[model samples]
Target: MNGAVSPLMQLLSEVETLKKQIAESEDPVLKESVGSTINAIVAYGQEAYSEMTQILDEFETFQKMEGLTEEQRNSLLAQSLDHFKDQMSDHEKDSFAKSCEDEYKGIWESLDGDSQEFLSTARYLGYALRMRGRGNYAPVINEMCRVFENELKKKIYNDYIVQMTQKQVVDMDSNTEPIKTAVSKKKKNKDYFISDTEMVCFIEALPSVKNNQSGYLSELKKYLQAEKWDIQKLSDSQYTKSAHNYIDNYRNDSAHANLMDEKKAEKCDRQTHKIIKHFIESKK
Candidate 1:
């Protein structure tokens, strides 16, 4: 009869066995306690299995790529790694980034190049997984990808002059009349490299905002109201109550319209929310 038992049937049978053992015990109190414990175990198992089924269903919903082949994936992986490897002097340095290298290569070898965009697309998914520590973030992933794409485009534009200056065709001598005009690329003034110490300080000084609906909104509001946004001052705990309406208005303004895709906007909101939480935790 056991030869054809389903998984649920097997678990139920085990529970029945436990119940029988508990019922047959000589000690009355011991029997009662054992029965209670067995019931709890069965209940816990059922709940855990239900949650696992829900997670599997959700995992199945991730965007699937069609027309991708294992060979093409391997080719792209080799190309990406070879391009990076060519820049390195020693195999040791190249091998130092082994995990990243192996993951990309393995992924490529498993899939095809028809889904070339998936390389960039998967980045945020990986980052969010690492950052949030494994949970549901379907909409968040879409938003992060949108933000990453925009940032990449900005980086390309910002590096254009640097790339040209390094080319052999470009004139370095001031005395000689150059065939092409000297391109002076404007430095983007953005605070991307805030020190961890400053971040910690900011977190410690954060007001006692309850980590609820009001807390999330309030933290974002602090960033929106920030007057200078200077990295140096980020570490200093100052009492400056700024309006979220101002930041919210600025977020909606046409000046930032170019960056305001629905996905990116959502991501931006989430990032801000996280920063606030980070700040609060650091202060503690």
Candidate 2:
């Protein structure tokens, strides 16, 4: 039976056994207290198992990858448990943290390159949330924009450049001049490094590298649309347009004044997470 049963199933079976024992006991008050306790345990276990199932479903793709081991699966689960730590009791948090940390160093090592980066970014976002909770909102928002612009945007721009120039073979003396001129023009016109408007334009210019679809552009446009942002009116660098605008506004306002409050910071934190999730999903 043990061999055939899943861990959750085994837990449920144990709950049933406890219920049976309670039913057989003769002490009325003892039965009442123990019955309530058993119900609570069963409810908690069911909730935990449901969450674990959802996490496993999310990682189903990872599990299908070649060379994944049982040990890696367990580690992945532990790493995932970190996200739910806040919802757990103090005792559960302690136990979960201890288990996760034992194999924490190897957790990312066991994942694929993309998975590793995804989880690392997510962990960083968690840190950003903690910082926001501690009332360090400006720095966290600034860092979020920096990651979006410098890391994600720069990566996409460089990849696009490589893809566009991949087949060209330039001569050292003659042909190289045109290639250099083109690159210079692309950089000047795209100007993604300077501001969010240029970054949006740069993203718009990029051809889709996957299935004839630009996932990054699509995801970004959806976010901008939801924010009621008009791309045409975003020509001015000072204008607040995209989610990056929130970062810029917060930075500028906070530098000269104490304008950032906890509520606004929490909203910014949520927007940052949404932006990060878009970047992560686009990579997939």
Candidate 3:
């Protein structure tokens, strides 16, 4: 029954509790202040934890020095610990310790009696560096990533999904119809929402599209190569059909009379096809 706790676990518990209390608070001002404080605490806790881990990792790297000794390591640790401590206020430091404690408590509560002793061991390991009073985080950070690359990847992916979900929700509620239309299209055709990074990757994967133009040429080349995409291959009758689709897709002429009178050659996708046909013929 040896009980030990981590600062991170403790901080997280406080945050959860504070969040609950904030939600129930009678005073609006108090609730707002509590929420803001909780946010700052959590933000600082994460940043400090990451920085401390990185510092430890760097110190570990220095351990390889030709004349590195226990005394040297302790001295460096002590100095770095003081520097990190000075970077935060007493309240922030306490918040960080509480976060670790909350994090450890969760793990301990989740375990069965058979492995209860593991809680103390895990907490000891988690808090050992903090107890050591040092801030060489580089080695610890590097080691953690090397050991948990998959976990890191999962975290990154989860974060991206959360962000995109929020963005999509907001886009749906936007007052601007243009933005709403874009959002609807993105929702309908996920591929159309391809991020700039994904688009670049797609273009690079298409080697044949490698004209002097960047990825733009790649996409253009793709369209040119498609069986249904070639303008020259299309008959005059097909052009008329495509022009109608283009106008129907882009032009908002709901009335039949409007469509008849404003035939300023509807253009758009049809015009693009004509331009591409000219280029293709010139090249031939």
Candidate 4:
């Protein structure tokens, strides 16, 4: 193998060259044997590539630990072992953040204007909360909730307006009272943003609107529930109760911040991403 090229890459390259050579050969039996061998080599190369990728991920994690003193690093390592056992190292948190970013970057870029704005902000905050420590995660998580609710409120309100407009124009006589009532209600709440209670109402009202879907809110609820998150509490109002609790109990504590303990931050980070990913997927 070449010194510069990875073993996996070298094997893959050799397999391709062998495949080309076998394609032009006259011996059928030799071709079949060599083709089988190439297939085996390709599979092994794929496994090697996966292993190397994981090693690279770990190395990247290690690089992030460079600035800490030995005692700090040892404490971090000990804490990680307590939470994650031998399977996880100090780099796991960073790895998780990086993996989520890489996996969803393309999908996030493809979102509609409002969705893109909300998700991009959420992702940035989540990354910051996980990777940086300025006691900013509290405010960031709060803002994340606000952004999510604001975007959802806009979507629901616009959808409702479109439905009402169509009904008013098409079925003028029959829908006159309902349209008048809806318009009055909307006009009365001009500055209203959906609170958790209002979000539940909006979701309940979705089935009545033309082109409105049913699965989004339900799926979001299910996802949160499966994660053991407090969905009803999250949806009862705009604030993320769990996130606020963490901020109040841990992040805001004077001693905790200087310790550089990331367990609480990691939890909030993951939950924020989960919420963002679920919202994006539901919209799609």
Alpha-carbon runs more than 4 Å astray in model 1: 1-17, 63-284
**CA-only RMSD, every prediction:** 22.7, 16.8, 26.3, 18.3
Task: Judge candidate 3 at residue 47 and give its lDDT.
Answer: 81
> Over the full model, what C-alpha lDDT does candidate 1 score relative to the true structure?
0.34
lDDT of 4 by residue, 25-142 (tens): 9999989998998989978756644543453333234325657643354344333222221222235334433444464575545334544343334344343333323343433333
lDDT of each: 0.34, 0.43, 0.38, 0.43
What residue pairs clash in candidate 1, if any at all?
A: 69-112, 73-108, 203-279, 204-283
Task: Pick the TM-score winner.
Answer: 4
User: Which has the better TM-score: candidate 1, or candidate 3?
Assistant: 3
Candidate 1 displacement at residue 259 in angstroms: 39
Badly placed stretches (over 4 Å) of model 4 are: 1-103, 118-133, 165-189, 204-265
* TM-score, prediction 2: 0.32
Q: Under the 3 Å rule for N, CA and C atoms, how many clashes does model 1 have?
A: 4
TM-score of each: 0.21, 0.32, 0.26, 0.34
lDDT of 3: 0.38
lDDT of 2 at 9: 41
- lDDT, model 4, position 132: 27
Candidate 2 per-residue C-alpha lDDT over 37-68 given as tens digits, one digit per residue, 9 for 90 to 100: 77877786667656644643443333344564
The candidate 1 region of ten consecutive residues with least summed lDDT is 250-259
